[model samples]
Target: MTSKRRATSVTGNIGESVLPLVAKQHLGAINPLDILPLNASSTAKSPDFRVRLHPQFPAAFRNVTGLTPNIAFNYWPAESKAVDTRGNANGSVDRAIQQLGAYWFGRHSFEPNVVGYGLVCCFIYRGTRINPLQEINFHVVAPASMSAQTSLLRRVRHHAANGGRNDFLDELKTDGSQSRRQLLDV
Candidate 1:
């Protein structure tokens, strides 16, 4: 018999594959921004998706890389117990926040893009098939000085205040026990 950890890994992998496609399709319906997954290789550090600024952004928001996000995206199914494989003790949320903030800065400082705006959306779910996402938390991560890198997740005040309990990133034992066929239905 497969171990629980092994089973859980499989379920997480299934969710990892399916969620992005479902999200892109669902969220991209009104698609203001370019909805693109960050590629599987990037999952270790960066957020799952990249919602870049709309091409019309310049015309609408004065065509400048300013307060509005030149780049944005969601961190899907941010499991509370998630730990970074990079030897960091922090969970998935913290890791995503840091990587994204750094990416935002790289875009901001660079001339071709010269982006000064970004959004960090964190989703933690006790969610079921009927509600695949619950307590979806989104915060517009503003442009700060380069030195502000480490403070990424903390910048989202409510999340910081809430810690990893009850509010922001609630602990969830995801469908680790669910069969692969069952997970696919969701």
Candidate 2:
């Protein structure tokens, strides 16, 4: 009988490989996904990152009486500093990443308890044109308090450890903003 050779698979998942990096560097910071080179090509459909948080969060925000989650994330960037709108930093279908970063990243007094992980979930073709998104999508857990030092990765990890699915999706839906428009006005 002739013996046949066994073939080993050489596939890789970018999301799977990138998860740990996100958890370590961006712990508790807003928008860890933006930092990573995530793609939404045919190979990958879901967001590159996801922060699982407890359902019982937003106690403080909830107590605000009339504040809504949608309004908070969508318009808050307008009040504070805006992200880089240049073609290099802000590209099409990638503005979400910047929004996430500007919200919770470097905007806290203390660190958040969270862990992040990323990996390649799909096999990328060799020489495949990797199209960089305009604003890469960033998955993060919303923070308890707003400060300049709170780590988004740590917050997500803590939420995971503590049992929560407080995933924050950051992306840009529009192009005209106070900060971004200023650059255009110039």
Best model per lDDT: 1
TM-score on alpha carbons, each prediction: 0.37, 0.22
Global Cα lDDT for candidate 2: 0.29
Per-residue lDDT tens digits for candidate 2, residues 41-138, read 45323344433222222343344322223222211211111122323322422333343333333232232221111111121212213432222222
lDDT per residue as tens, model 1, 89-145: 224444444454334333333322322233344444343344443343433433343
Alpha-carbon RMSD, each predicted model: 14.2, 16.7
> Which residue ranges in model 2 land beyond 4 Å of their true spot?
1-16, 25-45, 52-89, 92-172, 177-186
Residue 35 C-alpha lDDT in model 1: 52
| Alpha-carbon deviation at 124 in model 1, angstroms | 2.0
**Best model per TM-score:** 1
Model 2 scores worst on lDDT over the 10 consecutive residues at 73-82
Error of 2 at 83 (Å): 18
lDDT of candidate 1 vs native? Answer: 0.34
